[model samples]
Target chain A: MKKSDIIKLLILIIAVSLNVKTMKSMHANQAEINPDRAKISGKPVASFHKFWADVKWMMFIQHMGSIDLTTESNSKDLYQEAKDILDLDPGFYKVYELSALMLSAKTPDLAIDLLKRGQETHQNKNDWRLYSMAGNIRHQETFFNKKVNKREKLREAIGFYRLALKKPGVMPVLEKTYIKTRAQEAHEANNDVPLVIAELLEWDKYVNTKMAGSEYGMEGEGGDMFLSLEENTKKDILSLIQRVKREHQNNLAGKKTSKAMLASLFKGIHTCNSCYNEYGAGHKFCTDCSKPVKVYGICPNSQCRKTHSNGKFCEHCGTNVKPKKKKK
Target chain B: MDETFAIASSLWKRLLGVRVVYFLTICAVSLIAITNMYDILMIGESRALMVDTGMMLTTIAAMLTVISLAFDIPKELQSGIASVLLAKPLGRTHYLMGKLIGVSWVGIFITSLISIGFVVIYSMSHGAPPAGLVKALFLIVISVIPMASIVLFFSSFLNEAVAATISTVFIWVGYSLASLNGVTLFDLSLFSMGAEAFYNYEIPPSYLLKGVVSALLTAISIVCVTSFIFNKRDLQ
Candidate 1:
């Protein structure tokens, strides 16, 4: 045979061998029907049964895993199996996102790990939607952690809000706005009016200087600052401030209303400050009076309905009161 | 035109074919719709209902392609009627095109009617079809073009039974695998890895791959028809 024919024969052989190898590799990658694995894991080996079970477990995890972690929910097993199912079929990207979201409520660290795994496995691919979900989980974590520190809580809330805003997918602005307003309320409910007013002024200043050239214009430019305030119960804050100011003015006027309102305002402020110490942060004002109140001692005055701010005198009525000792 | 219509009517009468094909198509589609209903009830979740319907349509389309092409060509050849048919005003290409069109129309019509029935049942049980169902159905129909072309190509080359059955299964597997690859899966097991590599790395985008596959099948079908026209001597 000629040199050309020999080369052609060799090339054909190589081509056929490669094709056979490719075909073998294709079939070899499928999950084997391992009875032991199935028995231990309690997962079905059959494709249809496995697919059905995986989906069922995915739904179960979603519902149960979302409950408070402090509650003794039977979600641990569901979450574990859901992870296994994901490991079993990594192609099911929806399962990964759902599992992460669910797991975050119980074990935020595990949720973050799962999300990282998902990102690593399915990056810059069809499953990029999972990244946005992972970001949301991170945002929830930051929100939870913010409740730990009083002074840093607002800053942390802002960090979380900014992180969520930076994510690519279009999150509903209303939802974020609700979260931000709640954070602001929680902050105000903890601190005194001067602090809140200071924070608002600082935010206004930051917007003017830092966000001037950007899309987020000055306070009134895009109504960014005013929009945040719109959802807030301005009447509650305004009334509290007006009461405090009237008391201060009455202190100069030498009137009894000035003395009474000053004592009430001081008690209300003390209650809020004490509550922040107890509850950490994110406490709401009273549903009845819209005043920042705390659960401490009982009402001291016979006629007065409101509780005292851990004092011997009635802050509202100036009636000398007794501190009730605990029975235990 | 009258003569052509008369001949077409006569051909239909001579074949006694319409009823069997119609019955088979209905049975195929009904079986699919029933299975789909079972699937929906069993799953008990709101999924894209069109997915199951599309799968059934795919199977029906494949069956129609194989059965129609395999029988039509060999039956023409075996009866020594090819010469008589070619002797008429119609060319071999036109005859082949007409057969394909008629068979495809019958297949599509039956499948579509069954699909409508399935949709009605689904709506009654659930609600109106979701946003993407129509688009998905269009994709399934587009997929059948390649399936039919492949069957026609195989019919020209091979004997009826082997050609029809093999090509039917082959087309079903090929299309299913091709579409499955579009979805990402992360099982690093040998089987999944192989599938992923084949789908993600080896194959181009599904639309492009389907276009190429369909074009190739059409080209082969045309070649087969041309061969039949040139090679087969008249057995008068």
Candidate 2:
């Protein structure tokens, strides 16, 4: 061999050595992050790992079409097939979702396990559906899994909803379900009025934020839906406060506390002194309490006579509309 | 070096013009198109299915294009084409290097064409593919270098049939070892971004850098080894 060829060989040796070292480290790095690859025996080898996962997904869909979902044996078979598919490609999001949903019918615990596995997988950590669905399964397990403590399952479901709420882009329907579940839990287990009110307000804030961030002049029907939802939530808050105030009216200090809470929820609405029912602008009496109430912010001009919410001047006629202070 | 480039361009044109390469590419494109029909079957996962199938088909087509040279090399040598070419101003090392560069160029070009078709089809069915998928396709292009060099290494010393078989077996073993996490000198699986794309996981830039470096170094080393072996063999 020529001397030049000798030098080439030497360089090749060094290059190969470097490549082997890099590959070994690469393998080690992947091992650290790669969850244990599914170990199903006899799976055919393909050029790409995900390709087989795709094929298995097709087979799974075909099997899904043939099975009767209500049958216990069919559920078990479906779960096993899902497990195998997940073992090959743990990142298959729909597999985790559909399988967990179906498996929960017969095996709630296994469904939770699958969703929890999905949650642990890095790709799924931010996906809100898995967490919320897991919560739903746990919540319903009160009836399905007789061994579970009802209160404990409810608390677990609430906890899952909280996690789901933190993720961006949660569906409005899921939020509705979450709030209802929280209220039901509070009513049955704890009757913690303050906590329940706080959760309802949190949902209110989430809806408001979503509304605020929507594209200007482009919210379309979405804006109207949000507005309606906001209105309903505010009414709920008002009713809850009213119930508390009525319960506390016998004690002077408790009545004062309830009044303060009610004032915080509504900026300037007139409250009936006799029964604490809220009345609108220009109303002579509270609608529910049927007691005379003071009115404010009526336009001074008899011609305009518009009632403003709370302003020194009427918005319609620019006339000063502040109510005169009563002489003590 | 000019002679090397001359030989490379000529061989590249020859390989690119081969009917078999076009046939393989058409097969891949048609199969990828058929994968869209599997939409009803995949339930919400049809996008993932199509993406995985498109990438796999691209890899196979590109690899087959480069590996064709494994058979072509021995035929050229037996036909005394290498001898006639080496009789000129070209060095044996240049001849081998030229072939490697030419085959790798064809592999990358064909892979890119199919990838464009895939991205279009994928976009039509399911919005634009994630950036990770594009990166994954790019990795497949980078992979052709080492693959072409592996074929050259085997074809240098062995007959066409044996050379193609060993080259294929070596690549298959590399992928199998990857599944087992076994260390290898040239790990082809490092170039795969299929799982990342399927899961919509962002591949770290550091990993991408490492993969590109590893593939290039492996290709360079293998080509040098082939050159050494080819230099000692008698052309007659």
| DockQ for each numbered candidate | 0.07, 0.46
Instruction: Supply candidate 1's per-residue lDDT for A226.
Output: 30
lDDT of 1 by residue, A154-264 (tens): 444344344333334324352334344444544566554333333333333333444344433213334333333222333333343344443443333223322343343
TM-score of each: 0.46, 0.79
RMSD (Cα, Å) of model 1: 16.3
Evaluate all candidate structures by whole-model CA lDDT and list the values in order.
0.45, 0.75
Docking class of 1: incorrect
- lDDT (Cα, tens digit) per residue for candidate 1, span B181-218: 32111111111111122123222233333333333344
**The best candidate in terms of DockQ:** 2
| Error in Å for residue A294 of model 1 | 26
Off by over 4 Å in 1: A1-97, A105-136, A139-229, A233-328, B1-47, B51-59, B62-66, B75-95, B118-139, B142-145, B173-236
Q: What TM-score does the first chain of candidate 2 have?
A: 0.69
Q: Model 2 segments beyond 4 Å from truth? A: A1-5, A21-47, A144-147, A171-231, A241-261, A270-278, A288-311, A315-318, A323-328, B2-10, B34-39, B77-91, B122-131, B182-184, B197-212, B227-236
